[model samples]
Target: MSSGMAGANTEQPAGTRRNRTSEAGPAARRASRATDTNTEERVAVWDAVAAYVQEHLLVQKGVWIPTFGSFDTISKDIRTADGTVTLRWPVFQLARNLRAMHHLGSDKDSLPAHREVETLKYSEVAAAASVTWQRGKTCIQSTVSLLSNCLKNGENVAFVLKDIGVLLFEGMSFGIKYYYDFLEKLSGKEKFRKVVFKAPWLLDTLVSRVAPVASLTHSGHLVVFPM
Candidate 1:
């Protein structure tokens, strides 16, 4: 039996063995390359989405999706039944049209009595907001042009945007500084030390709000937003 096995092994050609190895090597290499490409594509997509969310949603305070919904953050500090304090994060709620399309019930009951979620269609809201942003951009552009023209003509131009608290074309810039200083005084460490530290209840009131049921998670960290 051993001699028979030896004869069979000897009969197997080296060229055939090399051919099999060469065939498997290329196929395995192709499969590995394909897997790597897919993984990279997925990672790229995830990163893009994360960046968009960070910039528009988190930084800008809110973002509206074309077909899905809007996302916004709401800070809420609350005490649990056992007296443990927790901060509730922001969450995304389904749009009215989306909810209706999915046959989901209205979220009116879940919302706070004092606040109302806009029920406008996504397209309408997006269009309106886009127009507003465009108008703001146009105003800024015109202001810049006016400033340039004034400077070129050797004239002093003082531009002020009351909403943003900005004074431009002046020797002193106070708009952003004043705004930031006000915000800092309102919510910064000094404010916390003087106000919240002395009156914890006021801090609780400032951060506390009626949260919706959808804003909770099993691990206690609320997911407030739907993917």
Candidate 2:
């Protein structure tokens, strides 16, 4: 008799399943709304930053976000085997921020310290115009604060722009490690002096800190980041 009863159908009624769905509907909707809100905030922040970079940095040397760091370009001439070529790298700096420095263990002191090469301070941060912050519900300051907190957790990545690449923070590494760098030339425009930007080459990071060539510093704006 027990075996026969076990073999009999014990399916839940359709209405019972519907009741469960109805019960979860509100909570599911709440979760969906929360995700959407977070996405909106992130998108808005990126849009503002993109506008600032396109408007100001393209014409000027770099853009400094007061509390955060500076996005300065260091232009240097390297005597390559081919010839002397001018390279521009829009260096994004956060090493100057006290809060961010506190999160990183010991090494990474400045945004992109010219260290690894031992003498290779990759490039220097040439002071540029600082962006005027507009008070808003979702702001850059708070967003960067969140990023610092994330870095403290030991695995996080923040990005400046799609073109520049990512700021990597991971376990097993002491300081900052940036990836996805490229070099492109913009010619024929003296007005609106275009800021040349590049990231560290994958091979460059894997192999050595500095490239195998002598770089001549034509203009040394030595003491940038005055404010």
Candidate 3:
């Protein structure tokens, strides 16, 4: 009797260990399943937005996404010496209410005051200007190439401007959406308009004029535009 009691004290019953494992297994599986479900839901939402934009673009010129902005397309015709070439591209405009969100100040006075602008000779000024122009051109070309690659590969891309906001592109038929902090701040005060207008590669032009390029990265097929 004493020996039997000692054995029972030293070892847990097989049923007891199995019951503990079974108890923890369900909880762990439940947590994992919850995480997977959340991820699936997010993907579903993204897919729904992509589907809506594709369908809208097919029937009309563009579509407006609430809490985001308007998306549209523009057509351009080039008259060359050989023949006329036509091209179509997409454009995004911040919602009218969100336009005031970004304050685009003049860069004319951005140069340092200590820089001798008036005392420079004409040749020196011209050379400096030429160098600046070449640098700008190279930057523009690189940015254009990044965007073109994204379109060609049908990969998702995102751009987060410093003063502006976030721009998201889902490359399945070229859908875009914009988000900003102001949208949330004024959420209760304003509503998104339903009107859609055919709005272009105009972004490339804008990027050239607006912010300086900061960083760029590509993961798998998706590209994150320069900040």
Question: Could you give me the TM-score of model 1 versus the true structure?
Answer: 0.28
Q: Give the TM-score (vs. native) of candidate 2.
A: 0.46
Sort by TM-score, best first: what order?
2, 3, 1
- The per-model lDDT (C-alpha) reads 0.29, 0.33, 0.32
Off by over 4 Å in 2: 1-37, 98-100, 103-137, 171-227
Native-referenced Cα lDDT, model 3? 0.32
TM-score of model 3 vs. true structure:
0.31
Candidate 1 versus truth, CA RMSD in Å, comes to 26.0
Candidate 3's displacement at residue 71, Å, is 1.5
- Please state the error at residue 226 of candidate 3 in Å: 17
Rank by lDDT (best first): 2, 3, 1
Those runs of model 1 whose alpha carbons end farther than 4 Å from true positions after fitting are 1-43, 56-60, 81-88, 106-227
Give a tens-digit lDDT track for model 3, residues 15-133: 11111222222323233333322322322333334344444433434655433345444444434454544433334543333233332122111222232211112233223334333
Off by over 4 Å in 3: 1-37, 79-81, 104-227
Question: TM-scores of all models?
Answer: 0.28, 0.46, 0.31
